[model samples]
Target: MFFRQHRYSNLIIPISYFLDLLIINAFASLLPIQFQTPVLFHAYISFGWIVISLKNEFYKIYRYTKVAYILRLIFTQFVFFFLILYAFIGFFKQPMISRLALAQYFVFVFIAVFTIKFLNYISLMRYREKIKGNIRNVVVIGENKKTNQLISVFKDRTDFGFNFMKQFSAKSLDFQKEECFKYIIENKIDEIYCSISELQNDELTQFINFADNNLKTLKFIPDNKKIFSKKLKFEYYDYIPVLSLRDIPLHNPINAFLKRAFDIIFSLIIILGLLTWLTPIIAILIALESKGPVFFRQNRNGIDNREFYCYKFRSMAPNNDADQAQATKNDMRVTRLGKVLRRTSIDELPQFYNVFFGTMSVVGPRPHMVKHTNEYSDKVDKYMVRHFVKPGITGLAQVRGYRGEIESDTDILNRIKFDIFYIENWSMFLDVKIIFQTILNAFKGEAKAY
Candidate 1:
């Protein structure tokens, strides 16, 4: 009944994931050179993939994620798959197959899965954009700036697949809950978003009863101006109730260890492999073009709103305003060599040191200058949520073409949306995806990369 009532809203990412593996194995079997492996080996491999992928949250796709983000996710899944596969093998006393044949299997299966998923992603995105596909009828049950903002975003971005059905004021609905219920039932609304402040006591009771009876989705938006975040956690203190607004996954011990280990290992690879030679070349170029420190350090907001000196190659000449001023396109402060560095994002390489030192992550919400943080926190509600995780050199917002200068209020607003999405749906797979997407965007050049 629930599945029938919420048709098209339940997008199971795990099904697509399983299909990718199934298709890969199916295609590989037809190849001219096939590895002879025991049936048990394949079954164990399948089980291993399922368990690890779930642990990594490989199947948690947000409603508004784009094609690029989807592909990045698949790329990450495959990247980590080998580690899981071999680790499973390493645990056994006797290996089942030749290393050479297994290598070929890995290569062929990865290529097949990656190609098919990419095509499917492109098709899905196009279908959603032009065909009114995956549309969800949603109604808001509150009157507030945030609710209006939600309506505006959904109305403007059809690609998100939210259909703004109607809104019911709590004050008015308090007297006549059935009126809202009638419209909901008649229209088959899929979800209801209510302001906790507006519908307390009996009004809240009716709202919950109606939704529960109909099996409709219910989401509560906090009414308080200062204290709402992605997740609302409940704790019991000797039977006393405790409510926490934070839902940051990185705070988990295992999750934190996973993320931090990846950050350290990945940063070390870059620092050793590329930075060893590339650093001197870039440093010399920067010095030749202008006179200042090779590295630029400025105070930015880090995890938990702590101040840290974020390091990047000095892409701009010495300026007293560097602390407060943002770099805009075609700015005179940027040198010729600086332009190349910024375009390729090599300017951010020094921050790998920060990642190695535990001050940053491989992927996260990009930290903003103290001035920008203070300025925007007032303008944007829930803006402080991004600071719950350690800042990153490249983030979901940056890869989604929201990086560089915040020229308008809309720009920052959209950036915050992507950041919040990353926080809410975080995983090691996501960080890997964002890292890959960052590299791809750098090569293709982003809109605000200047």
Candidate 2:
């Protein structure tokens, strides 16, 4: 009776994703360069494309969009889509993806997708009418603040096509459930917004049954207290219901896998290409400057409160307070070589092995000392949330001048804030951005790095 229903419309994007690929390959066949698939290509595109789409939220639609909006989404989605595509090709060591063909494919795809958007927009416009054809009459059956807010929203958002009907106070027992249902029928009400807290269980059940039996929609209006946090979402299993805070993005499986995949590849490149020759020279420098071992190892808290021996070049000489105290500026324990290592950020490079071993990541919350982890989790808000993702060699906090020794509670608080933000809103693009910024900051040298 309203605008449209999209029960099967979810298939449009998935089908179009592959259709664009086929059109690209068709035109690419005309060129001298050929696109060939590797053994992993089947495993990747078969299930991975759908998983990537799900991660990128390319399918879910809560409302219709203008053609411009759809075009923007298409461009952004394809950028990420191809980012993962190229990542897979490089990670699996597959045959070369044809650059010319890939470019031509998108050119054609943009044109085709552009046309498709206008068609969808036109179809939606054709379906929507000004009066009863595309509008729904809804009423509020409660007198609470939340109910008022709901009514106000419906009244104001004319684009939603909600025609605000009369509201009745649930306090007035004069309006019984039967009478309310009768009123809804008389008014041709399309939805009933009821405050569950205001109604008796039996009365609520009666409204529910009536709404179902009458083919009218019923939406529960929850009091603000029940919501607690804006991040909470509801899910159902069989008949049981559950409310959960939305999982941080890095904690999601597809996202975690992508981060780990990049970690392994990036770590291997440094370990094999750079470390192969650079390690022994740094080892000699450490041996000459210090009396103890070439590497310093200490336990640090990792993902899920687990502790692991994080590695670093032995910057500070052997000290009894190594694990308990943080390094201070002009500390005697720091050797000349150690000062250079700390200043240049080379001391943190050994953690690349942690990344390769799956214990850490290349970009994340910098691992805290076990003592600091225990101390700050109590003092800071949402500090433990940082541990939700693997600790990193460098992170958003480090590049943003929140790195190094904590001089005040404000320092740790700000650092934890950035760490939590990175965990909650992570993306491979963000990781890359953080990595580049970190490299730039390293060259500039951090004053409080010690």
Candidate 3:
């Protein structure tokens, strides 16, 4: 199974350890300090590293090679090792540890660890070339152009290790009962890749059930390219494999809990501490200008296109529903206080509470009004993918000056480009950078902001 090919490869651990040691040594050699107890310090560091790696699940094999995942692992583990070292050596004021050794340890370890993996990948490629290993005997259960492409790909890139065993046409198969099972048994199949659209619902279900019962691997390659499903990890029940798409990036229990904790702390500081003071000032100004409500509420599309009422300071006339025209520069709709609120982004202060409630994120693709969503989604290609994660108070597009009126289709399309790019290349560092840039942009006063 492609998923389990690298399972239980303790090789990854020792490689990591060697890499860490090399990095530490390199840093140590550059520093002035010398080790009083080199062996004991080395053992303590090595053991601590191993325990940290296990706790972080750095050894668990991934389904595919992703730079993001690997970089994340390296960063988290690097922090853990350094923090532990600092506490044990720096705070305790231990002189036994060499500063040079510590520095070398970090650099060498990281380099060695990733290098070994890269070499291992190269070695595997060579091995596959020699023995024809890693070859996937693919049984594509479709006869569409996509299936034809798959066959062509296999023929073209034998290096990719695909060996097409047979092609199953939906029209020819008698899928009323055990049809897939009978076919598989007859063909001596290794794996099944099915396009859900190629078969009727009942037939697809029957085949899936048969595959589950037989413990065979089932890979779904949907024909709808617009949907943009990703390679997700599967959960098994006995022999049954269940596939999932909405594996929330933050919903990983640890990350979810941590993000929530940060949100609560952050929201508390903003709402009770900061907004408690700013809201009244804004309200008085807003009330004096417009003679209406202090806050505006409207439906915005959230994760998975779910509707949620987003809150903001009433930055326009009280009756401006989402159907009203988008606020434009020097538009008559802008109230005196509304101009300031929108300019400095004081209108978005209410969303801290939304973030606190876990309905919105501090940084993500900025949510659009439900009407705008319906209007622009059709106009912009792959527009719906922006809803893959929770909408944000600000986003990459807004930071890049794509806010305010969408006068042109190109504007909406470019905004969607940044949104999709952010989703595909998301990271904690990216989020932090976006937040920082949003703050800087807020003070600079975005030209597009009405």
Candidate 4:
């Protein structure tokens, strides 16, 4: 069966890792510095190399990865590795180990590793082009400018190793889904490329299910309209851009774990260090001003559109419209203390608990009230895509002055645009940057903070 085919390609990463490690140790042995414990030295450097490579994604070169990206990885990896080498010598007080010899060792290792990497990359391209090995037989499922561009890539870039078998016009009356399926099965098509703009919702789902069942790779050729946005991940087939709709960085298990860990650790600090005392003080102030619960909880749309009761300091007098209406600037429902709370963004501090409980993140798209979520989702395009990640206490949209009342449709639309950007291009540094900016915004006071 096509699904049962042995994929030796899976072994490439591991094999590459092993070869790099081998090169590192072999060069270490040739160094003039006589290590007191040779095995210890080798193990330390090898472990350091692996850790650094994994952190930098040094070996994540793909067929579509640009040569410039590979060079950047190599530069980043070697710079860090050089620091690791010097740190080892300094920490161990290796007086006998000559710095000059170590530098030479570093140069030799870089030369050897660089030569091997490029050689392998070029060899694979040559092998695919000349021998037609490691080829994927693919079919295009639409006829359009974008699809034609992609088809041209498959035909021209033999080094990419895609064999274009046929083109099926999804819009054509003569095009039958069953016939396409039969052809795919009989010809052992390895991948299916569909024009997302050309297919109906049902047609897209059917192809997705068919590809999933057959273990065939599925990709989309998106319309050029959304290509300018960073919301979707784009890869170049030669010069043609092909997008993956759901390929956000946080979708990776490692990245998701890292973001979640940051959320938990950061929330713990706030909840224990600040909120423990601040919550009671705020509660007393709210009680003094109005009659209501210290913590206001309302159901909000969370990750995957799941409903969760989001927590915030009680910033309004008990009212019927708390869940249905957003707080407007100079609104009467806001208590005297609520005005102060909202202005300083202290009302949002209680959401750290939500973060600790894992219902939200420290930095992500902000969750909206259920009423607004339902209303906007119907009216706004790609608004629901923000639900792909956990809601944040303060998001890119909030920091960028899109928070508070939605005065106009453009306000919500701009918020959605920022939210989508955050979801797609998330990183640890980006989260930290947003947190710092949020702090600065609170101190300065935003016009929309009312």
Best by TM-score: 4
Per-residue CA lDDT of candidate 1, range 102-180, in tens? 5677787787767766666556656556887776788988887767777776677766666789988876625467788
Task: Order the numbered candidates by lDDT, best leading.
Answer: 4, 1, 2, 3
* Model 1: ten consecutive residues of lowest lDDT: 235-244
Which pairs clash (backbone N, Cα, C closer than 3 Å) in model 2?
A: none
Q: Which runs of model 3 end up more than 4 angstroms from their true locations?
A: 1-253, 320-322
- Clashing pairs for model 4 are none
Candidate 4, residue 222: Cα displacement in angstroms equals 10
lDDT of 2 by residue, 151-188 (tens): 76666545445678888888985867667778898988
Candidate closer to the true structure by TM-score (higher is better), 2 or 4: 4
- Residue runs of model 2 more than 4 Å from their true location after superposition: 1-231, 239-241
- Give the Å error, residue 359, model 4: 1.2
Which RMSD values do the candidates have, in order? Answer: 17.7, 16.3, 13.8, 10.3
Number of the candidate with higher lDDT, 3 or 4: 4
What TM-score, computed on C-alpha atoms, does each candidate reach?
0.52, 0.55, 0.54, 0.59
lDDT of candidate 3 at residue 33, scale 0 to 100 = 49
Cα displacement (Å) at residue 301, model 3: 0.8
Give one digit per residue, the lDDT tens place, for model 4 in 228-301: 34355667786776766456677554466678778889899998899988888887888888887999999998
Q: After aligning candidate 3 to the native by TM-score, how far in Å is the CA of 130 from where it should be?
A: 47
Model 2, 430: alpha-carbon shift in Å?
A: 0.9
